[model samples]
Structures are given as structure tokens and as C-alpha cells.
Target: MTTSKAFIQPLDRVAIALMLLISLLIGLIIWQGDAVKPRVRTFTWENQQIGSEDVSFTLTFSRPMDTKSVEDNLKIEPPLAGKISWAGRRMVYTLLTPAPYGTNYKVQLQGAKDKFASQESSNRLVQPFTGAFRTRDRAIIYIGVNPEEKGRLILYNLTQEQKKVLTPKDLVVMDFEPFPNGEKILFSARTTNDQDLLSAQLYTVTTGIASQADQEPESPGRVDLVLDNKTYQNLKFDLSPDGETIVIQRGNKSNPGDFGLWVMPTSTESGEKPTAKPLKSQPGGDFMITPDSKAVAVAQGAGAAILPIEGDATKPLDFLPQFGLVQAFSKDGSQAAMVKFNTDYTRDLFLVTNQGTQKPLLKTTGSILNCQFDPSSPTLYCLLTQLVSKEQYIEQPYVVAIDLKTAQQKPLLVLPIAQRNVHMNLSPDGLGLLFDQVVAQEVNAPLSGNTLKTDDGEAIATSDLWLMPLLPIADTTTADIKPEKLPLNGFDPYWLP
Candidate 1:
């Protein structure tokens, strides 16, 4: 030993110390590797609420998990119960029986052990969930029809089980008007139809079945037929809000040239035919009655004219120039919507007041087929279609709505191109829209033998009645109340109010 000590230097001793320190670090790493505890970074769930069907869960480890160990140690309760099948790494548990409508469930995962014998603690999770929904009731539809038999009005309430028919036989129902109260209906009928052409036969509906005498004759149905003459052509008629008077367009059907405006009482006594008085002239087109029932808006010649029910007899309303075809009036009677055309036959919508001031409501690159005011709101809905080229006669239809106050135009609905001859009508509440959509189907014929011959067969024409809510115009997602084929092919749908 003494001989070696004489040769050993200080540098040799330092090198030996460094080698021992490195060896100690290597041994510590090997011993600590499997013994280190794993920290759970976070707990996640597939869903806080689970259904009664199948539920699955997954656990993420800070390090790569031993798939074999997890599959062997994982357990679920109320137990998989033969209803669950594992999907590789994930453990799935399904209930053998469906849980109640609202039931709370618990999931327990047993701590899994590692190859080094390190154990993971157990975790518990509770999930509350609900079951599926049940079915709903069927919708009901009310149908109104004026039978071909004179003085007969039939109202049928069609439901899933039975149909209820309401016939006021004692009262000759002329036209059915939905009462403001909605419980009962208001109708004008021929209480007495005097055979005489111009007899003052009193026509009235039972406010209460003839209980009193004076109430019957106070407001008789004596409507005047303005275009009674052979040359007069009937256009369209609108009833006043009070249902006392009607404004109609009288024109020459044969000539298709002459036109005039007429005001009638809308009711006549038994055997008494109400007389029509001329309101205005000059090739009358469309007419609308103001809600206040004090004025009538008539589309004549080049513009719309408002005639006061109680004004100067000599002069007609000052024409609101550039506004043609006054189609509708706002609910407040403060605005009138009309359409005008140019030399190229492009139609545009314009709004005007009874004072003869006019402004553009909608400016379209294409023609506007028809437009109407929402009876319940200030919005104006229009049906617009592109002008069909000479080469093609059929064109697609689109519905657009314009806020009268904001002057914003937006598309409401775009019907399929296959639907032609489209017409739209707004409901009384302005919350629903009714439209007639015409669809055509091609018919094919089977030729002799196995060969098939395709030829243009009879085109099936059908007019369907469609209804949609006015709200959520942008979504265009609506539940069709009832899409029914017309009992008999008909169009020009109008709601009675």
C-alpha cells in the first residue's frame, strides 16, 4: 500500500470521485422509474348526461397507458350485464333495461395496476339523463263552402275522428265572415229574396235569432251590382272593415277595354237587389277599401286615386302619379301599395299615402307578379317572378318581404322551379301565409314487348294549398299545417275576416 501511495497523484483521485458520482445517478434513475406516482392532469367526460341506451368512457394517462392492463382491470356497474361490448381501448356499458324518464346513474372505474405493480386509485362519476319523447296530437282544419243551392251556407270542421257541420238553416247565409271574437261567425244571407228586381227586401243575419224586430232591419244586405250593364266587366271586390260596403271593379268583359269603380251596400232584402253607384271611371283595374271604411283606393289609368266616402261630389281624388294598380292598403289606411310598369314591361312596387304622396317600396330587376300588405303589421309581402323570355314561358317564383318603415327587402321563400302559376295570399293575422302551387307531372307509356316508349302524355295539373308561418323568414323552415290538393281545381284564395 505504501509503495502505491507514493505513485498516486491528486488528479487521479479527482477522476475517481467523478466516476463514482455518475454511477450513483444512474442507479437512482433506475430505482425511481416504476415507483414514481402518476398525476392526473384532468378528468374529462364524454357527456355529463347519458341516455339509457349505451354509455362509454375513456381515461387518459399522463404517459402511454398499458392497453392490456386497462382492459383486464376496468369494471363498470350496474355491470355491463351482457349488454355491453368493448370497443378496443374504450369500455362500453349498456343497460339491459331502459332507464325511467328521468334517472340518475353512477359509473365506477376500478384502479388499474401497471407492470411494475403501481396501482391507480378508483374514480366515481354520476350522470343524469332523460328518456325519449312521446307523440303529439293531430291538427284540425276548418272548411267553409257556399253550397250551389241558393241561400245555403255550410261550415264543416274536419278533425281526425269526426266532421261537425254547422248550418244556420233559419238564416240564409250569403257569405261567411269570421267574427272578431272568433267564437261565432258573421254572415250575410238573403233573409228574404223578393222576386222583384228592385224591391227593398230586407236581408239580415241573426245577431240573435230574430229575438227583437228593429235589430233585423237596421243593417240589411243590399249590395249594388255596379256593372249590371251588359258591357261592364267584373274585376275584383273588397269588403269594408265594418262589412257594410264593398268596392268593386266594373268593366266591359267583351271589350276588355272599358272599366269603372262602383260602391255597393253588400246586402239586399228578400227579393230586393241592391243597386250599384259609380264611384270613379277611366278603365278601373284593382280596388282596395281602407280599414277605416271612410275611403276607397282605386287603381285607374296611370296612378292610384283615393276617394273620400264623404267628400266633394264633383272632383275625384288627385292622382298619385307614377303609381299604378293599387293592390293593397296598410292596416291603418295610412299607406297604399301599388305597382307600376315601364316601356320594357318591368314592374316595380310603390307606396303612397291618401294625400297623394308616393315613394318606392321595392325596386326589382324583374317583374312583380303580385303584392299585398300584412293586415296585422307594417310589413309588405310580395310575389316576384322574373320576366319569362320569349323562348321560355315558365319561370320560377320567389316571395319577398319589405319592411315599410325600414325599407329593407329580404327573400322569404323560393319555390321549386317545377311549380308554375303560383299565387300567394296572407292570412288575416299576418302570421300565416297561404299560397297556391301548381305542379305538373309527365306521364310515360309502356310500349309492346319489353321495350319502353317514352312520349309526352297528358300533363297532370294540380293546385296545392300550402300554409306557413310568417316569422322566421330567413330560416324558411316550417311545419306544413296541411298541404291539401284542391277539392276542385281552384285559385285566387282569400281569407274571410
Candidate 2:
């Protein structure tokens, strides 16, 4: 009986060992099935609101993430303790309670673990970001007028606290130019009693006091700056970089033809009057003074030239296959930009160097209404318009940046709707843009058509000013940086330093 019992015990022991081995194999398979494969990629958090009680930002992954795994693994801390919600596969976290305004806030995203087995998990990670900004105290002003009065000018404060109106009291403000220091503005006011007679005047505004320098009690402004009525009709003018001289186009009213280029001293004694002397005269012309204030670029008739401000003769810079207009000169007078008018009357932008070199800055795609150079960068900001499918002229305006070095052009902002009589004015620091925006409704055309019309055809005029902050290109990825619009309007906007 003892021998039989001992044999049964040994068999029992062998059976138990086999069962234990099977259980161990099953446990190994279960552990392998639950293992996770991990990966790490850099992500940017955006839309972080500054000066808010609570700050929130959205984390965008390079690729779609596992919603369940992300929700379970991710963690965010007042300044950032908040619940996270799924935003179309992206993770968005927000504070449950509002945080104090103007207080600094930080956000950290810990590493996430996946549910895939047979992959090793990554180390825990954390990324820190800040949210903070000061309250804004600025306003935007928008202005609009009849198409004939396109030369409106505007002036506002840096903080947007104060504003002044400098448009000619009774006459139409034509060809307005701001001084280099931005304290004074020069504009031509035309009095059309019987015929078109124009007088160019300079208005100086300092410490909130507005007065006409040429019309001062002690000193009368120059009335003969252009002198010839026929010449002044088709003439355009610009101020030198130093604001010490004015470059104008001059001709006789009897002739009513393209006169020539003339430079006149902008400043003089109460009794002393400066004379404007012709620099270059040719038909079908335009000219721009270089920012350096040393030279003037001229495009007359079928030829283009560059001449010294005080020179008697001008040198031919470059000859174009087709005639074009010299729109602007670079700051150092090293480059000149031109606009080519096509058969359809659309314009394209090009650059011409001091050595007579020409290069295309913007291609002719749509009708370009206006183009201005950024004072700080080598880019041109232009207003573009195109025809819509409905046969209506839809003016789609954009702020574009043209990289002179690479000849690359990029659109920075797009207007929501068509704006008419639109104008763009950039700040001296390149931080803001003042533009005219017009919203046109199909109200009945007034009998006069000079003002806005109501639905019943009664004329009614309405326009607004828009202020847009020029965002730094480097910070384009940040969604929280929104352009602030100022609330004011006047023609020709000049920003005070």
C-alpha cells in the first residue's frame, strides 16, 4: 500500500508542474498583447488668449492621434488646470474657472502612451508655454468719398487716443504727402470756380494744434508752385525724404500736355519764395524722389531716367520695350520699381536697380489698384481686384509681401468682401496698416449719384476706417495674434512717430 501511494504522489507532482508551465505561457502572451509602441513629435499650441481670466490653447499633432489613449495619458495643469475637449481630433484644454487678467499662465503637455503591444513606451515629457498680453487701448478710423476724391489723407496717434482732420476745408484734397517726420502734411487743394485752378499747400500739425504753414499770418503759402494751369491738371507730386523739397510734374494749361519734372524747395523765409526748375521734360510721364533725398527717378514719354535733384541734365537709366510708370524709389536710391500697364489697363510691379537692371516683383494676374512699399522691409503691399463670375467687379483686396531677394510674393491677409475706393497706408514702424473699406449696397442711384443712395434711390454715403496690425512673419503660426481694427476715418492716413 505504501509503494502504491508513493507512485501516485510522484505522478501528481508531474501533472501540477505541466499545468504551471501552461499558465506561465498564457501570462506571457497577455503581457505582450497589452504592450504599447510609443513615438514623439514636436507640436505647437496655439490660440492662447492673453489678458484673460483663464487661458486656453489647442495642441495640434503632426498626425491624427488615438482619442482614447490621448485623453487617458495627457495631463495639463491653473494657469492651466482645466478639462480637455476634442476638437476634430485635436486636443483642446481650457481652465474651468476664469483666471486673473494680465496674469502669466503656463501650459505643459506630458508624453502620451499608446495601446499597441510589443512596443516599448517612451519617457515622460513636458513642454512649457506662456500666455500673457496687455489690454489694447487703440481705435481704427475708416473714411470714404466719391471716386474723384481719391487723394484723401488721414493722421492719427500712436496709441490711437487722439485724432485730427486735415482734409481741405472746402476744396478737394488732392495728392497728399506726409512729411518725413510725420508731423506735417502737404496736399494740393483745387478751386474750380470756372476752370480747374489748383494750389499746393503744406499744413503742419504739432501738439494737437493744426495750422497751414504757407497760409500763416506772417507767411503766405506758394500759389505759383506749379504756375501753369494746364500743367497742373495732369501733374502729380511727392515729397523728398528730408521733407525739404517737392518734386512735381509741370506744364502750361494752354498746352495741357505732359510738362516735365521739377524740384522746389519746401521751406523758405516769410517773404522769400522758392522757384521750381525743370529737371526733365518729356510727354507721358511720372517721377518719384528716392528715399535718400539725393536723386529723382523719372519716366518720361518712352524713356526712363535718373537725375540729381539739382542737375540740369538727366541720364537715361533704362529703356522699356513698352512704356511704364515709375511708381517708387528704394530707400537708399539703389532701386526703382515700376508698373506696366497692359492692353487691358491692368498694372504689374517691377523693380529697376540703379544700374538699369529690371526685375518683376508682382505678376499681372488681376487689376492692381494700388501698391505701397513697407518702410522697414523690402516688400511691397498691394491692393488687388478681380471680376467675379456674376459679371460684377469684385475688389478682393490683400496685403502681399514681395521678397525682393527671392522674387517671391505671398499674400498675408484677405478682405472678407469687396471694398471700393480702398487705400492702404502703412505705419512708419511697419507694425500697423490703415486702409479704407467701403461696403456698397445696391441702393437706388441718387439723382445726383454723388452720395450714397437708399433703397428708394435717395443718396446716402457711408464708409468706415479699418486698422490692422502688421503681424511679424516669424510669428505667423500663433493663432492668438489677431489684428486690431481702429475706429476712426479721414482721407490720407499718416501715423505720427
Candidate 3:
């Protein structure tokens, strides 16, 4: 009756409540030891858009997982075969083949227990997890063949059936190469009023397509000049696989004899325009950027030289004195399809590797126009011209797929002997091949404005683009696959990366 009323301050009451909560948590832990469920904490590719180069994805778990249990329980919709590896609580799945373009995929994980989960426990498995990712849309870029859209760079989405013109009518797009992201195209074009093809300058045009999921589509036909033709005449240009550098064959306007390869950045710091600089090396022919994007493979005097474009380009990084031309490099840069000029005028296609192994794949009596390595398979697709008629000396262009392991060759398409101006390209997904047959027109008038020609300089009368669906290397019935004539009217067709 005499004791004063006990008071509990706000701070004291909060501390008492926290202690009780801690005590309760400890009691629950003691009663249910190691019973907590595991879960997928994060998925690297979840709800994202990926390309053919994205060959692996990762999953991180809330707790260390049983590697075998997780591997056995993991499921991928559409059934992609891959290898699994583990690093602590993270799991990585590397695809044996590239995922097809314009496809959505799902990954699911369940019924997989954690590292410490007891076999006797009923609920020790990982919580059900589902994630999804999508590949980019299949698209092609070509200089339009129709009169209305002729000489303009055109982008057509094969998956969406959407088309957009990327260049203006006044600018006749002479040649173009897409950036790795497909958001822009590096092209050489001249004014419709200017008749000189050599007067063309280097430029980049927006495709009005988004390269990534988070990026908004750019406005189409937004043109930016990269190299002006005022001082140097830009001839042929090659964009690096990494899309950071551009190597352009340029000749001085004042001194036409002064010509060499000029290296420039695809983009520059804000407010500063990109400028081209001399490569500080001997002039060479038929140059291409190496797959690693660090060197240039050029046909020197009697051999092919790999010159480092990063620094000290004068010193050849590696020289293959036997090979006269570097046709194509595998996507990984580990192997290359090189051309060796023979004394008898025949060319030998050799498989050259970085491991110092050079194996002759085939010998070609005709020209090796182009060759591309399959991204997902050990195959090389090549376009060559065979001398069909010894009397007429006619060269017939044909495409062949060569198995790298066995050196077996499969003829894909044989073009008309007259279609020597034909151009071919392989799809990034390795599922299709694109080529065009051109009907050259006799131009009585002097070569002038907006009069497009085949790359071989024949005036273009018309062109038809064809697509050949490719079969998996495991398939025995590849002969049954036929070429489909696309509805598009274009030439020099190329697949968007």
C-alpha cells in the first residue's frame, strides 16, 4: 500500500521487447535446428534479353546447395543441353550451343535440397523457383532493291515482320556494316547529286531498334557523319567485332597515291567528334579486324600479318609468311580459315589455330569469296566460285558447309555461273544462311548518282534475296533443307548480329 507506482521508460520497454524476441528466436532455432528452407536468391539472366554471345547464366542460392541434387532437379523449358558447375552457393550453366534467336526460355528449380538438409526432413528442399529470359529478334539489314527505297539502308525484323528504312533518298548507301548491337549501321554513302562513288564518306545511321532490354529504341534515320571525304577519300571500311574501332582504307584527296589504313573510334567522348588517325604501318590489302578486336589481319607482301592496332602497329604481332590472306576467324579467335596461294595459282584453305596448328582443310581452284564459322557448331560455311566452264572460263559461285573435325564438305547452294556478284552471309544463330543473286543492267549512261551497282561494279537491274535453313550438325538429312525466297527485294543482305 505504501510502494510508489513502478514506471517503465519508452527506451527500457523497447529493450525488454527486443530481448524477448531474441529469446523466442533462440528457442525456435533450438527446436527446429537446420530446418530452414533454401531458395534461389538471384538469377543473372532473369527477365533479361540476351544474344548469341551470352553462353552462360548463373543462379545464386540463399544457402549452399547440394551440387548433384540441384543439377538433377534443374529444368530448362525448350530443353537446352548444357554443363553445370558450382562455386559456393552459386551455380552456373554453360550452354553447349548458342540459344536460338527470337525465342523465350524458362528455367525452373525445385526438389533440390540444401547442403545441410537432412534426408529425414520433409520440407528441407529448395523453394520452387522460376525464371525467364528472351533472345533478340531476328533481323536483316540490306540496301533496298525497290525503286522507291533504293540505295537506302533498310532494316527488316524477320521475327516481327516489321520494316524500316534507315537512310534518306538523297544519300545513296554504297556499303554498310552493322554495329555489334544492331542499333546502328556504319556505312559509306554519297549524295544523290554526287556521281563519284569514291566521294562517299563514313557515317552511322540509327536503326530505330533497341539493342538491350533497358535501352529505348532510337529514332530511325538519325544520321551522323564519322569521317568526311573533304581531306581523305574513304574507300572500304571494316568494323571491329567488339564495335569499338573502325579501320577504313583512305586515300588523301590531294595526293591520290597516298593511301593506307586509318584507325578511328566508332564513338567519342561527348561534344568531341571521332577523328581518324594513320595506323603507322605499311599499306596492305583485304584487311579485317581480328575476332579479339585487338589486331588487324592484313594481306602483306607475301604473307598475312596480324598487326596490333592497340600499340606499335608497325611491328607485326604474328606473321604467317605462308598464308596470303586471312579469310575468316572463328568467333573465339582461336582458329582461322586462311588462304594460302599456291605456285600453280590454286588457293589452299587452311585451318590455322592460335595453338600453332595449321591444317589444310581444302584446296580451291576458284576464289574464296567469304567464309564464316558456325557459332554453335564446329562447322565453317564458305562462299566460293568454281571454274565450271574451262572454255568460257565461267566462275560459278556456290556455298558449302565444312565440318571442322572430319573435313567433310556439304554443298549447300550452287548459284548461277553468271551470278559472280552474289553476296552471302551467315546468321548469328547458325540456323540460316542469306545470299542474293543479282541481275546486272547495262548502264549506257556514265556512272552517276543513285545508280546502284553490285559490289563487283555491275549496274544492278534487280536482285533476289534467298534464305537457306540450316540443319543441326547431328542431322543426317541436311540435303532436304531448301532455300526459301524471302519477300524482300534487296541485295548485299546481311544478318543483324
Candidate 4:
């Protein structure tokens, strides 16, 4: 037994040789100083499609890197302007602005050297890295106005020049808001047999776009009913920025006075249907979900109250008494554009901030139809009407860019006068503005499934979608910019996030 234990097999000799080789390599590495090329240990956004919410990408190296060398040698195709920062072996590239939609981008770093690379004898350099990323395609969703596709939600891929009808012709889509991912749209529609405008029900329809690059895109026009209008009439609705919560204004059918804002999760547990829970707060008007998605800003009484959608709804998180309406909030949620109804029958738009700053932005004699904050810049784009004639009370709708920092207002375009149904949506990249110029139908027919109406609820004969490219506020004037009319005929056109 002792002789058998002393015998070493050929396999054991091979293992011992491998161990000696590895030890020798390790000893050489330590004795001669590390000569191995630095490599990227991790990359946060490799081969990913990012959106507005993605502000930065990170790179972690196997060893500490020269910050200035890495920043100077790094290159991004399509030339994204960004600021580089470092923390030991990690590097972060913060985008100066959201990358434009419908574009593919590449990042390269071949010449960047690690901090300890200079002392090595062999070619002291970092391993060449080539990473790729992309932004979501440029797309828009609108209610189709064509004879064959009337009253249906249509998703038009501007980048691919592809169009898909998202809702069927049997139901007339009243209003819709795209999910943050653009994979689905939340909309309200009424059945073909039901003509009452207030009888619309909430539904979700697939957009034929996959939420992830690896997932296969499903066919569009698959509709799922979310909430029925049998007990309550669902009015205006808003989807939170995170796409996790939905706030809808509802009014009880039996009790005319029973009305308030309702909150619900966009998803539910497995085998559980989504349900809406009434928010225990005062009745609100023109409600919207805050940027955080945890609270709802509702126009209650004479103030805009920020009420938690979840626990303790009765206690408001905040209240701004000066603002009668919240037009829009900045993506950062630090500021908001609010409206105040003046005693002299005027509307004043103010820039209200979370830092207890209420700065006046604009004053209008007519209505402040809508306003959106530019996600990339210190600007607020608004669609408003001006009282051109007192006798006729003629109001002309126009688009204007207001610089939040300098308080400079630039009139972009003056739309057709008295087009109250006109709607405007700012592009996610802050490079374009979309607005619909609608032609109202003279016939006052009863509401039907085939009948189309503007977002204002007025019957419309035809509508044209227009896209206007925006310039930096300081670079040029409105005279140089032009509004390009799209080939689609639809109202309430909105950019798919």
C-alpha cells in the first residue's frame, strides 16, 4: 500500500507541469513589472438602444486610466458632445444632450493609455475597444383620418417610412398617449354601436415595435380593454414618465357630482387583471402624473395639488396656489410651466420651480393651449392664441419658444387663425415640433364610429400634420425656419417616446 501511494501517474506529472508553468508566468509578471495590456473590465451600454432617459454611459478599466488621454482619444460617431469624468479605474461620459432619434452611434477608444502603462516595456497601451449603441426610431402616433382608416390609431415610423394602423375601424379612438417605451399606446375609444362621446373606454393597443432588440415584434392592432365606462366616464388621462402609472379623471355615471382622479398600475400580478383605485382626494380638473410617477398633480379648487397616488392620498405632497393649471413639467421635475387666470380675463404663464421660485414667463390675452419643456435645453415651447381682434374676439394660434434662463420669447410660427382644435407636441430630442392643422366639418352629425373629431371634440373634415425643425434660440430667427407638412392626415399628432 505504501509503494502504491508513492507512485506518481503521467496525468499528475502533467498537472504539476501546468502548475509550474503558471507559477513561472506569475513570477515573471511580478518580477518584470506588469506588461499585460490594460483592458476594459466592463461597459455599461454596449450594443444597446437608448432613449431620452439615458444620460450617460460608463467604462471600467482593469487598471487606473489617464483621464485626459482617454477623454481626448475617445471618439463617437455622429459626434455626440459629452463631458468625460473619471473615478480611479472608471470613466463616465455624460451626454450634453439626448441623442437624436432614428440614428445609430458608435464609440471607439484605441489610443487611450492606462496610468501604469507607461512603465511597461512591451507596447504599453489599452486594448482597443469599439462599442455601438442606437437611439429609438423616429415615430409618431395619430388618429387616422383616411376614409379606409378613419378614427383608428395609426403608428407611422418616420425613419422607416412604415405605417401601421394600431386600432381597428370598429372603434373610434378618442384620445391616446404612447407608453414611454413606445411598445404600446394607452387610448380611449367607443364601440361602433355606441355614439356617445362620454361612453369611451380605456384600452391598450400594441404598436408593432418590440420593447427590446432581442424580442420579436408582435403584429400591431391587438387591443385589450383596460377599463369600461359603464360605472364611470373616463375623461382626460396621463401616463407617467416611467410608464408605470396611469392617472385618469373619472366621473360617476349615476351620481353626476361624484368625480375625482383615479390611479392604477400599468401592470398587475400574474393572472390578475389591472384595476383602478379611486384616489381619496378632492375632485380635480386637468390632472397629470408628476415626473417621479409617485404623485399626481391635480387642479383642485384654485390651486394645483400634488397628491400621492399611493399611500395617504388625502395629504398633499405640495400645493401651488398661484397656478390654476399645470401645462407641463421639465424632464428633471425641478421646474414646471403653470398658468394663472387673471382677474382681467387674461392668462399668465409662469415658470414654477421646486426651489420655491415662481418666475413669470408669459402673459396671453387669449388661451394658453399647450406648453412643453424642451428636454435638451433651457427652453419651453408653447402653443398659444393671441387676441387679434377684440370685436370678433378672433384668436390666432401660434408656436413660440421661451428661453427659461434669459426669459426671451421667440415667436416661431403663426398657425391658421381660430383653429382651436390645433395641437402641438415637441419632439423628444427637442429638434422638432409637431402640430396638426385641422379643418372642421360643417355638418353637425351625431357622433358615430366613422365620424372623426379633433381633440377638442369638434367634428373635423380633414387635418394635416406639420413638422417644424427647431434651431438654437440664439443661432437664428423664425424667418429662416420652415414648417414641413407631412403626408399623413391625422389630428392630435404625438411623437412616440
- Model 3, range 250-341, lDDT digits (tens) per residue? 99989977989999987777857777899988889989999989999999889999999889988999999999999999998999999999
lDDT of 2 at 280: 61
RMSD (Cα, Å) for all candidates, in order, is 25.3, 20.6, 2.4, 2.9
Off by over 4 Å in 2: 1-154, 191-234, 268-271, 314-323, 341-348, 355-357, 387-395, 416-420, 439-460, 478-483
lDDT against the true structure, each candidate = 0.49, 0.52, 0.89, 0.87
Off by over 4 Å in 4: 1-23, 120-123, 443-449
C-alpha lDDT (0 to 100) for residue 426 of candidate 3: 90
Best by lDDT: 3
lDDT of 4: 0.87
Instruction: Tell me how far the alpha carbon of residue 238 in candidate 1 is from the true structure, in angstroms, after superposition.
Output: 2.3
Q: For model 2, how does the per-residue alpha-carbon lDDT over 1-497 read when each residue is reduced to its tens digit?
A: 35534346788999999999999988998976533223323333322323221245566653345566566655443333467787554667675433332233344444443333214354322233232222222222222254543323343444545654444324444455655533455665444222233343433322232222222222212222323343344357778878888877766656655466667887677757666766663443556776777766666565555567765444543355454667656545677667777777566678877676778777554556566665556666666665443366555666666777777766666776555456677654456677655555445643331233222232325455666666544455523445555454343344432
Across 343-399, the per-residue lDDT of candidate 4 in tens digits comes to 998999999998989899989999999999998889999999999988999999988
lDDT tens digits by residue: candidate 1, 1-497? 35534676899999999999999988998866544443222333322333222223344444433455555554533333324344433334344332221223344434443333434332321122222221111111222222332233322221123332343333333234433212233333333332211121223232121211222322222232222434554345566776667665665557555556677775576646666776644555666677788777666667767676555523555566577777777766777778887767667788877676767877654657777786545678888875455466556678888888777787767777635456677654455566765444344533211111111222323344565556633334433332444343323344322
Task: Give the Å error, residue 171, model 3.
Answer: 1.1
Q: How does model 1 fare in lDDT?
A: 0.49
Between candidates 3 and 4, which one is better according to TM-score? 3
